[model samples]
Target: MLNGERLTGTGRSKLTAALALAFLGAVTSVSGTSAQSAVPKPGASVFTTDIAPILQAKCEACHRAGSSAPMSLRTYEETRPWARSIKARVSRREMPPWHIDKTVGIQHFKNDISLSDQQIEKIVSWIDAGAPRGDPNDMPPAREWGNGEQWNIGEPDLVVMSPKRVVPAHGPDWWGDLEVDPQLTEDRWIQAIETKPVGVARRVVHHAGTTLIQPDGARESLSEFAVGKYGDIYPEGAGRLLRAGSKISFGVHFHSVGEELPVVIEVGYKLYPRGYVPKHKVTEVNVGVINGHLFDDLDIPANSVTRHEAFAKLEKAARIISYQPHMHIRGKAMTMDAIYPNGQAQTLSSVDRFDFNWHVAYVYDDDYAPLLPAGTILHTVGIHDNTAANRLNPDPNQWVGFGNRTFDDMLQCHVLLYYMDDAEYQQQVAERQAKKKSQTTQNQ
Candidate 1:
């Protein structure tokens, strides 16, 4: 069974019937045709007053023209045909692509784009009401967006391009390093960084992880570009240093498409003001298997569900900035837990439904980010389904193991850490406690 549904024989029939009834009930509830009055009241002028505002704030950023999403939701005329589809997607909590489990773990995030329950209800109600364009004048002003080539981190202080490479029409996957000089005359702290494939490169490039090589020959991970990752923006008072005479190295993985294509990667950096030093330096660590070989001991039987666990112990107190789970097509779910020195275990994050297509990096809000003491062990559990029930699974009959290709599977989680001394860690803990006390007092 996958996602609590059996995929074969009579089981599949039951699953289908259950889904149909759920969908029908949703439609009826929103339409006010059901006997149960527990459904939320339909919004007043939902399309313009309620639904449009939510889309403008959360969806239009990507759903606009020339954006990554396939359809535009800017105007009623453009969105009417997709109203039912939008309702269905939002009802399943699949759109906007934020997959963090709400019931468990830290709930505060700075970059959360998931719609609230009320927003989803409004959307469903709008679609059930025949998607009427309630009042032309009630429509919100259309959101303004930059052209497709615009940088997500605003104008960059510096831009570097990787050496161009060619991908043949058909061949095995290619992996190599493409290095380039940024030509910075002095050291600078990077506040934000973004990497993207230029032009045709987007089609054939699977992933490109860039590293910073300093003049002293020290290396540091800079940033990475993948399907679901937009970019990395350091939290307030925290930044990564990019020293002078540093070179950028890109570890690129390119797979062949149907047509030959040339690829180039563009890296953008937004730097802090001159002579500015951040309070903390962010360090990224991949918390996975100790040996760092993600699937070395993996043996997944055909048509079965499997689980794997990995652990990373922190030698110093650290504040975790973000959590990003990485897996191949067969990945189903992943959870991160923290075992404190006092032996108290708490889950930091749980992504119940892991969608390989969007490798989202959940940036924890400052107040709620995990603060771990020395010796805290981060434990990650990953679940994989290698059965026909997994629609993305290519072959259920074949045993699967780790390889570089897309057909293979691997499990890993990327976490950003800001190491702190005992004094600083205690100071932060005290401040958080004070703030929480104030909030509770205000509520009372």
Candidate 2:
């Protein structure tokens, strides 16, 4: 359990402001009926003429040529067959993959390819209208690619690489974790982080997350291990500590996607601390372990809808700073309510449709924030589908679990908070960060 000291009123209010959003809520949830309403058959020429421009401008970057996408939509011939796939993913708000919130105001990346409702509708209408390829002259110029090798800021001070893991030729996907030790050069404070593969190992390796060694300043290979799950609870020690001399043991996991090869990787961290005084502690609440009771598996049905609920009781002096809900492909919808001891309740998140691939953390504005006295129950309600439509549903007929490893399913919720008097925790953060810096410097 995390240090649960109650936050001060001023602390709660201010921390709420500082805990702004970290992702794009670009994906919108759509019901099966709504999804079907968005697609049109090949008779639509606008899908080739007008709609093609949208895909080229917003999607082709990652979906074309040699990218990791499952298929290529390089031309009308290639795209004609996947019209339904495009419609489903787009209507469900799954394409142009962006996770930041667009309903309220939020910044965006320069290369952001997310689609607006208007854009989505336009494509849908064109397909429905028999897709007129307007005219060749109407086609917008193709987007030029700039070198992406440049870092978001500049060179990372330290780079940690993992050992090579082998994959057999032609078989089921491999699920394994590899550890890395990055001895820091000097004590430092990191503001950002990124990871990449070490060599030409395309068939293996997907994504990775890490945890730092407690008190010892060593990195614990958490995501890699299958036996000892650090914890399925949120705010757990699932993060790697960063301090001078801190040794990092990163947990790397990859899926086969039906290919075979060996893989290695380098995870990078960017440091920043010059802007403002760090007072309130910002964190994440991961929703997991589901259903009628605590830590129990949910009994949901295939080709049906099931609702799961969870609550985190808050202390009288507590106030929620921000909230985020996560679920995989089977997720249909989600909502959060803050119920006080006095019976007053505040709605936190009321999403209509939940997209597993588009789930993200939602940070609310402090102006209209809610405060709860003791007995404040932060409630989360989520709807799920295990039908054939869910692309990631391994066995739509089979149910899954809440543990990490990605194979099992989860029906839980987390409420990340930033509270007052979190200075001590922040100090611990700083101490560990310093150790990471020292370790990086010593290694150099």
Candidate 3:
């Protein structure tokens, strides 16, 4: 099923719908319980013992007070009222907001917040059992979180703010670039970077993309912030270069939110210790719609579902660190594949349910990150639904095309990777092969 409903589109869509149904069936069977059998017994005590721990580990990060989530789930009092909502969301695999399809493609990630099948079952069972508080002593210690003002990347070594802009109560979307000086005296390596719209600006800002302008006039994309994105934290031994005497530019996209508001974009950079240089420099590659063109022939008819495919060929051997699918409201799903020179193709990642509210970049674990040789082609297939079935669709009767506004449509994927020489690539491939063999043997 595509978005929990059968699709009556092309042959491929029918096949995808069949596969999705089969996958859901497999998941339900593997959990060793049917929907009726999975219901909890009356008066079962599950909240403090089973459900609380799961929430603490998975949900509380964002669902706690001062976080972005609408309500806090830190205690039974704060959570009891939302029990039914939680059950519905978790049963649909929509809560905690991890949208990557688990049945296919790479399964491991460094920052995966998705709950397991057993965890989902537990949450549903608890809610059905009346969401009891049970023994208070069984509750685990509360997880500590920084105040709302704290940066996600921890205390940053440097912080910069963009020039303030006033967004009108109602107007056309605004797009402009604002530049700020970092005033660095010496070169530094960036370990992590975060960008956010301050206060009420979060409601109006669609995205704030920061770029680094070097003293020599060269520019590099530093980091970006969307609604659901956290921050970019480079893996160990890899970092982005920040030259001395560099200025930062903020490319802000603001949409009116029914109230006039003044907005400022804040950027934070966590730096590597002085005198330390990273082995690999991280770079971002954006695979745009229909063969690398950002806004070329992206037409979606009213009340129809359309699919667009894009391809990018690598000029150098590289290790892909993350995959972030980008689209507007009409976006339904996206799948990324890597076609090697020898003609073998592998699906690296697939976001089956692409929610525009959550623009997450799934970061691969170091060992599982794809190592591709030069000439490998990255293929991306994005699906867009301009029909009433897409609840996020602003107007199903309006044909959508490429534009900067949220109502219009665009298709793209952001891939973060570090290029390497042929020798290093070969060595890494061999190491990965050996590691896989060892894992297989251990499992046997």
Candidate whose TM-score is highest: 1
Per candidate, the number of residue pairs that clash is: 0, 56, 0
TM-score of each: 0.80, 0.60, 0.80
Q: lDDT of each structure?
A: 0.78, 0.51, 0.80
lDDT string for model 3 (18-45, tens) is: 5445544533221212321334465564
Evaluate residue 63 in candidate 1 and report its C-alpha lDDT on the 0 to 100 scale: 75
- What's the CA RMSD for each of the models? 6.7, 15.7, 7.8
Model 3 Cα displacement at 126 (Å)?
1.5
lDDT of 2 by residue, 1-444 (tens): 011112223332234222211111232323333333345454444644567777777777556643445556656545654454455557656565554445533233232456988889886655344334444465566555443333443566556676777766555544445544566545554444455554444324444445555336533322221110111111221222255566555555455544566666555565444343344333434444532453665556656667888766654334344444556557766677777678877665565555553333343443323444455677877777777665456678776545455555566565545443434435545565787689899999
Of 1 and 2, the candidate ahead on TM-score is 1
* Lowest summed lDDT window (length 10), candidate 1: 29-38
Candidate 1 per-residue lDDT, tens place, 384-414, comes to 8999878678798989887656678777788
Model 2: lDDT of residue 336: 78
Q: Candidate order by TM-score, highest to lowest?
A: 1, 3, 2
**Model 3 off-target regions past 4 Å?**
1-45, 149-155, 164-188, 196-209, 213-221, 225-230, 243-247, 251-265, 272-277, 440-444
